[model samples]
Target chain A: MSEADPVLLNPEVARPYLDRGGDLPALPLGPEGLDRHTRRDLLKEEMAIAKEFHGGAMWPYAVAAFSCFAVWLAFFPLAIMGELNLTVGFVLSCIFATGGYVTSHEAMHSNIGRPGEKNRWLNEAVGAVSTIPIVFPFSMARMMHLEHHYHCNDPVKDPDYTDEAPNALWAWYKTWYNRQPGVDGSIHHYKRILAGMGTPEAARALKETMLLQLVFMAVLFTMAWSGYAIEAGLLWWLPRHIGLSYIRFYLSWAPHHPREGKTGRYEQANIFKSRLGHVLSMGMETHMIHHLYPGIPNHRTRKAYLALKPVLQQRGVDCSAL
Target chain B: MQAAVRGLFSWMPLLFGIGFIAPLIAQIMQRLDIPAPAGISPILFGLLIGAPWGLLTVVRGRWL
Candidate 1:
């Protein structure tokens, strides 16, 4: 889609609206524009360039998931046996758990597997297992994520865009938590939307996984009741707490906020210009370009954005987010 | 059936909010007998109680 053209500076310099009493006409479509054939050809050319860094590898996601699992699980026993400080162990485990969630996010997008029919389910399954420790249901998460993409930046329609007005951090927190009842009502509706799209089986799969939250609760209680409250708190609860906050604050707030007052549909997306922000956010920092072409997997979004930088600039699309 | 499920879920955050806070309120009343802080409005107290419940309901967010 084309960016909105600037309005004419002088009424005499504008094409007059036939019915207008005194209004200047909007940008008109014309014969002098790029033809349909050329548009398609150019898009195909850019996508081909994007494909070079677009990954279809499962090993990296697997390695990230396994790293989280091993490091987080190992922290428990070592802390219990007094080999490592409980607080330190807990802090370190939370960091690794956040890494695991990055894998889960990739998995949700079906980017953790080879681009093939058979590997789709494999990706979802790996995501499900990887997210269990964080109390996330993969199928459910997939549904919501698709909605986020489908309705990005829509205040009413998108679940992620809660605060429509600007406010301080504490004010937003208080508004989100203390004020709202029945929050995330968008999720139940989005589930129906997904099911209606011929993925009823995926919806049913999500329903079945709701019990896992209870199972997670039971696991925590069992650990706490067995006189390992500190261990349970650190290894289980703390890391997941970190995971939850990291997802909300880092992945959610940081990537979308700081709009520099430009809330136009294409301009509102946030990008990380800093290397640390890019690394920490799993490459979601260069987000506006990714949103332009959602099919370009996360690992390669930065590369794809850079590849199309000239085009974005020439089109007058804002890349200041980057 | 879909509407009914949706209605039920729409109430869940409110229910979970009360569930999470009612016990905490009870514990405070039993142990410390804490009163509403001086100069705190009833509306503010209500919000404080509701916020954690809301926070807990959503912190297990599926997306974002």
Candidate 2:
């Protein structure tokens, strides 16, 4: 294939690079009149398997989340008794939180059971227990997340890919604020989200969190009043918000950064497959695959991701670690 | 700058207090062979354990 073919430097490949605040380079499309291979076909088989795997794994993920929740509550009063220290409680709590989040994520994708009412109820119930209310339903997240996959590198369209001017400015302001005070700027960013005074999505999430917090406060307030309040405020509330905000920020950015001067859908896929690609991404890492096939479950994503790695690389797509 | 410095200074006590007190308490509990207390209700137990654990796990899994 000669380097002069226009297809090689198609608009889809070039547009994202330009959006990442870079100069546009002249891309040479490979050899004229060359037959393009069926790109989607390459992933067809893997995509099918990915869907199947996600379907089966969703229930197990839900059960795991519920179990973690049970364990967390059983051990929580120890905080009041001063039997369990903050760090240990914090660490153990984090483990349970992760399990819950993973279960919710699977439910969001309908990976826990059949994609119907049963799955929705399970997702919402699990979500409520995890402190993410059913108000921000899995259906809503799935829809937005699908958009994120569809326009992975498009700075304007992908809700998750926020390179918008105002957002960027806020991010910059946040960094400066943290640096000036020797506090991690990221923490400030997180606190802002926890406040639930930002975007609509944030507001919705915050509402759910606040409701849960209120219930938590009531319980703590009733239990030896002062002791419960102190433990709940110091250990439970602050840490949960901080931890949730931190993870959200990292996951939001990991999959769609610019690489090798490309920043469009294809390059985003490349990044998703390369830098952020991992077994744990649970199908999230195979961002390109997810974009192309949203119905595929997270559990099956690892296989699809690996299957397309070599082919994507050959097409001049570079996936680099962040 | 002064505010930053003061804030930093103030946090010293909080840091030391939490760091010292937490582990010390855990050690005492260990020595006494006391098991951590469970929540009063099943749902409460789930909330206490699930809520914090869920947040921590998600953060650790993603960041670490």
Candidate 3:
């Protein structure tokens, strides 16, 4: 393919550069147009095993996890009331806040309640409540997340492209840098993308984002005024910052690092060893599988990735990490 | 109206961080027996330090 090939705009390819300076590798994007050499029977065998992992059993776990996080967030006030130890509360809040995104993420992909399924309300409910710690609204998260999927490494279109950095330390710095006032990163960046889209979902997301931010600020101000500023800082504000940084590092940057020119589906995400391990790292080691088959629930991704590994390798995916 | 709201939201962190969190932190440090430099009052010390840092973040969009 020449430098001017139109395939660069395939929505899956990160194209137009959008001022993210540096040379993008000119590899052919993703698995599109590639023929799998597997016999029909063998291909069917691979798909059948993979399909077994995609289903609705994820709802119960999603609901239970959402309840735990909500209850945990509720306990923050008890610490302010002097009924709980602030140190203990802060530690637990950090754990819950960091873990909250994966559950909401599962709901974002509709793994909890797929469209037309009987339990779709439960999915939306989980998504709505799960991110209370991080203060990101479900509507905004869903809209932005879906767009990231559609344009994974797109610097201009991908809300998460801001997380892209040269190394782990820079990636960590970006999570905070993106949210600083006047920086078009994090929610601010998403607001720009949503404004450009001009869809009902985008509008709703923007509205929800505003309301959530107001509520978050009101709560912090209330706590500070009530002589519980320390409690508020440890319980919510600090935890949210730490959790956002961790979530962005593992969930966005690590999975899709060196994002330039990587617009293809298979090329978009990678399997890599996480220093924090699978559960601690938010199950991002198997993130590429989730990108390929979002319907597979988070808990089942490792198993499904193993089952589908041969087929992925056959299709030119880099699966050596697992 | 939305733009106005967004502008307010953008200014909030700096305002809250400097005005509330910084002074409160000063009080906590004092309680832990840490003395402010130049014999300054804890709240004044907090304001002295936080005001410039917060203004910088608001202007440059980063603290560091």
Q: What overall lDDT goes with each candidate model?
A: 0.59, 0.47, 0.80
Can you rank all candidates by TM-score, best first?
3, 1, 2
True contacts kept of each: 0.03, 0.00, 0.41
- Candidate 2 residue A265 Cα shift, in angstroms, is 4.2
**lDDT tens digits, residue span A1-322, model 2:** 2333456356665566567977654444232212344334434544454555334446666676677667677656777677877677676675555445556665555545544665667766665565331122333344455555555655454554432223424543432333222342332333333354356665564444344434553453454233343455445544555445434433444344332233443456534442334644434455565555545555665666566556555544554532
Top candidate on DockQ is 3
**Candidate 3 TM-score to native:** 0.86
Query: Which regions of candidate 3 fall more than 4 Å away from where they truly are?
Result: A1-46, B37-40
Candidate 1, residues A1-322, lDDT tens digits: the string is 3423333433444445434666543353222233345445556776677667666556777777776677667776786676878777777777766666677777777776645767776676668767766676777776677667777776654655653335447424623342233343323444445565576666664564546654655565455434455566677766776666566555656667653444554465665564467878667677776666666667778878888776555445556756
TM-score of chain A for each candidate? 0.74, 0.61, 0.86
Q: List the residue pairs that clash in candidate 1.
A: A177-B51, A178-B51, A272-A285
Evaluate residue A54 in candidate 3 and report its C-alpha lDDT on the 0 to 100 scale. 86
The stretch of ten residues in a row with the least summed lDDT in candidate 1 chain A is: A178-187
Chain B TM-score (each prediction, in order): 0.41, 0.43, 0.74
| Ranking of models by DockQ | 3, 1, 2
RMSD in order of candidates: 8.3, 12.4, 7.2
User: Under the 3 Å rule for N, CA and C atoms, how many clashes does model 1 have?
Assistant: 3
